[model samples]
Target: MALPFLPAEHIPSMFDELDEHGDNDRLDAVMAYVFSIWINRSVFSMECWSIFMKGVRTKNECE
Candidate 1:
């Protein structure tokens, strides 16, 4: 499956929030949030694909 795409709006702010020391707490929080969402979507997509494939196989077996 393809990787999950994050929302475009979050991209700019994440870059803007970064500092030379890379010590921005808010950026870390935002990144964590976005990462969690991406992970969830990827897993959900895989599960859906598995279900669809299972249905296809069952239908083919019955034919």
Candidate 2:
């Protein structure tokens, strides 16, 4: 499916930005300071948060 606001060309830039910081493990911390490429960032906020949450989720169940 196509992204709601971002163009295909900008996707690479996103990955590049993420990669610049380090590995996927640091994505959550990096995401907190990210804001670009997408024209309507607010619309993508949930998606970003979703990615961050998924990466940080632990095997232990929530108590």
Candidate 3:
């Protein structure tokens, strides 16, 4: 699959934002951040979001 269109410079900022959340609500914070991206970018649909989240869950499970 093609990588998402985020620019290189935006990555650190995103991580910095994520870092603000406490560990207890980290997953919720991440989902909110992802939803923000979907809303701002307007290229990804809810279907894509759902699939991406499922992948995240699977990855976490494997670890």
Winner by TM-score: 1
Model 1 clash pairs are: none
**Model 3 CA lDDT for position 37:** 73
For residues 1-63, what per-residue lDDT tens digits would candidate 1 score against the true structure?
122222333433443454233568886776567556543355544333333223344546666
Error of 1 at 53 (Å): 27
In the range 13-56, model 3's lDDT, one tens digit per residue, is: 56456556636676776656764775446586434544322434
Return the TM-score for each candidate structure: 0.29, 0.26, 0.28
lDDT of each: 0.44, 0.47, 0.49
Which runs in model 2 stand beyond 4 Å of their true positions?
Answer: 1-5, 23-63
Model 1's alpha-carbon lDDT is: 0.44
Tens digits of per-residue lDDT, candidate 2, 12-37, equal 46655655777575675555445353
Question: Is candidate 1 or 2 superior in TM-score?
Answer: 1
| lDDT of prediction 2 | 0.47
Which one is best on lDDT?
3
Lowest lDDT 10-mer window, candidate 3?
1-10
Clashes of each: 0, 0, 0
